[model samples]
Target: MTTTLHVAIDSKTKKAVVFPLVFSGVILLLMMIFGVVMLLGQGKLIELNPNMFYKIMTIHGTGMIGVSALAGSCIIWYFLKQYVPLNTAVFRLNVYLFLVGVAMVLVGIFAYDFAGAWTFLYPLPAQSGGMWGKTGAALYLGGMLVIGTGFLILLLEAARAIIKQYGSLATSLGWPQILGKEKGFGPPPTVVASTMVCIVDIIALITGAALLSMSLINVFVPSFTIDPLLAKNLTYAFGHVFANSIIYMGVIVVYELLPRYTGRPWKSNKIFLIAWNMSTLFTLIVYPHHLLMDFVMPKWMIVMGQVLSYMNGLPVLVVTAFGALMIVYRSGIKWDVASSFLYLSMFGWVIGVVPAIIDATIVINHVMHNTKWVPGHFHIYMGLGACAMILGFMYYLTRLEGGRIDNKLDYLTLWLYILAFLGLTGSFLFSGKSSAPRRWAEHLPEWIPADMVAAFFGTFVTITFLLFLVRFISYSSNIGSKINQSDDIRPSTHG
Candidate 1:
């Protein structure tokens, strides 16, 4: 195999990279804005109808999830080009497909009331009103299918490149080949983990696409027995895995980028690798946990779900925490805005893991299965933890793109965001424990006046998010015009 020199970022690739980054940022901002508005209004603190609340929920979830997937793909694309021999033509095609797919999904969401949750479980879609609703569901599913297709193509291309470069999956999996001992140029851990993730995504895409297609067929074509159980299983199967994979990808960013700003080694310790592998394996099988509330599911399956859910915490606590700890107490610790944000992400993960662990229990699951606690736990885990990772990664990319970081401002804003987010969501969780239900627009019980707490917290969160929006916009606009070396406080030369 022939070796090549490192690729430099040029004007063309830079433009390509900036487009998706900007788009993703805009989408995320819009989601946050709409979310705040919806929460404030629907909680009866500001007064809004059920229809408006549902609409906002649909927009927020669709925008947030779609943007997240796009951001992940963009990150994969941007870094893959630096080392991997990606096919430019295929890459370009994938970008367009993703864009088109996202557009269709958005249009579908806006066309009708899709309060079926982002999961869009079957029978609910069937139970909804009129033809437009059905059509919207079709369009949404179609759009997701198209996006999955694009992801598959990208994965295939990456796999082909890996095979061409390193011979076979076996060779790539081997120690020498992966360690880059043969050529004196080791691939980053992100690249290796990315390859594995792509493979998993491909399988997920196929399974999800097939199930979605079956559902659509059952909708249009008569004489098709739409197995509700099968469809539900497939939907959750895809939803659970897909959602978890975002965190998996975020972990790569955490491991690869965080250490850069912290002046620490990117340690791919054996335990870390094992944890990662086990997490991935466990993710594929953990979908049953969502079905624990259902009676039709087997007793053993329900038990397995709880067991896996608890087991999932091991990798996160041991591997993720230990790795961060390695850098925390090291000599010459330098904390910049990006590093501060990264550290905060770990903190969010730590706080979230407790609620997540509690929710995994059969007893607690019985009480808080579909309550506000669910969103509360996930907001910390995925929103603060995964989303914070995305924010930090974007900050790193901004720096890489030659943006000057305002260390003081960034650090202050990071703390504000985290504190407000926790305060708001923590109140929501408290309400859930007090038997408050989720997705209610109005007529909340007089005894449960948690909306007051939520409203107060929401105000703080809104301001913090708005602050982030301003910082992001200003930084992006002035990215190429300044150089502040003070932000680069860490030792530049890695040992």
Candidate 2:
């Protein structure tokens, strides 16, 4: 008989992961506030510099993506620690490199006004007209390079740890079990989710790195221009995969934590394993939808994008959403800040997917491609879904050490956050229905009311997050203390 042991995550490692998670949460909050303010300026409610608006837009978009990815990494690392012993040194290194990259990006955007938006689409950075110089472009792209390096290293570390523990990637992803050849521990759902994301993101990062390198070269040698179509494809290919992975990261939180609240175990079954495996492949193939409006794109690629877009959401969203509902339906679960947010995020995921699928349709894409619908769909998923997952994980950690929170206040703030976000995204959808264009620094008089409504709801969101931050700081301090005091209490096991 063999007894398997579950190793404890190191206190130092927990500290490393927690600090970054909280810091990224703060960055995420700030980005949202700034984004809302920028939208207000676009509405012309407040006078703002057009260049400054784009500059803030650049930072807000990149910062939100970066912070979401960082938070997801932390969640994966912390949970992965339970199944496999991780190299703490490598984990810390990832943190240092990521923060350094973030700093460089902030300087490039704020100090020098690198306002090409997050995509840094081909020729835009180099041809900034007069708003930003070559150095700013170089700095921003370089920062992305650094950030990609950190994430690549992090995924590599995760792969190493998973393979070491499970013997092979096949086993880690439960392919053997899916094939009926093996009956191993079958890889927990979190392990399966993390493994899938690691593989996909590694590929995404490589694409990102290749493009950034080319962009940097062009920045210095203006004569060496790349193909705009090739650049756009690679850029969106990387960007779409990277953005999708953020939700997958959040999914692990649902897999690992939601069970605890519902007193159920989310194990690796055939459907679960198959769903994740499909996600890994479809996420890569769905980038073409972003290029549907580009007439130069190959017709076959556009069709592939539409087909894959429909397939990609099927496995994860349907399975996870249904699975979550089953767990909570009559489980007599305790609904706290952490569990409530986690559960509610699934609704965001599903609701957001409806619009995403609609937009992927070829006819719809022709009309709505550049409308506010794009932002509306994205914010619905990421703002409400991914952010909610990260915040829920943070709250879970703080309360892990037997820390108590005010139930009334937590529920109030959660509702406020949800309602405000719905309002904000609703405003976007309504405006988009009226053919409101996106990425405009100024809006027409007809669109003014929509922008103002979105901005108004955004304020409620800001207030809710402010309250969350206070509780986060207060309770997180207890986590550090609890680390020193308790060794047997694994909050991974819900009461």
Top-scoring candidate (lDDT): 2
Among all windows of 10 consecutive residues in model 2, the one with the lowest summed lDDT is 1-10
Give TM per candidate: 0.87, 0.95
Computed on alpha carbons, the lDDT of every model, listed in order, comes to 0.68, 0.85
The TM-score of predicted model 2 comes to 0.95
Model 2 per-residue lDDT tens digits across residues 353-391: 899899999999899989999999999999788989988
Q: Where in model 1 is the C-alpha error above 4 Å?
A: 1-14, 88-92, 129-132, 167-187, 446-448, 477-487, 492-495
lDDT of 1 by residue, 1-495 (tens): 111111243435544555566777777777877777766775566767777677677667766776776667656665666656777667667778888887877777777555556776776655566534667777777777887788778778877887787776444433453354454323455655566567667777788888878766755764565777878888877877777666666666666655655556565544555555566667777788898788898789788888999877468456776678776665355566666667777887778878877888998889898788887887787668777877776776565554655567667777888888888788879877877677666636551466666667767766766676566656565343334313445544334
What is the alpha-carbon lDDT of model 2 when measured against the actual structure? 0.85
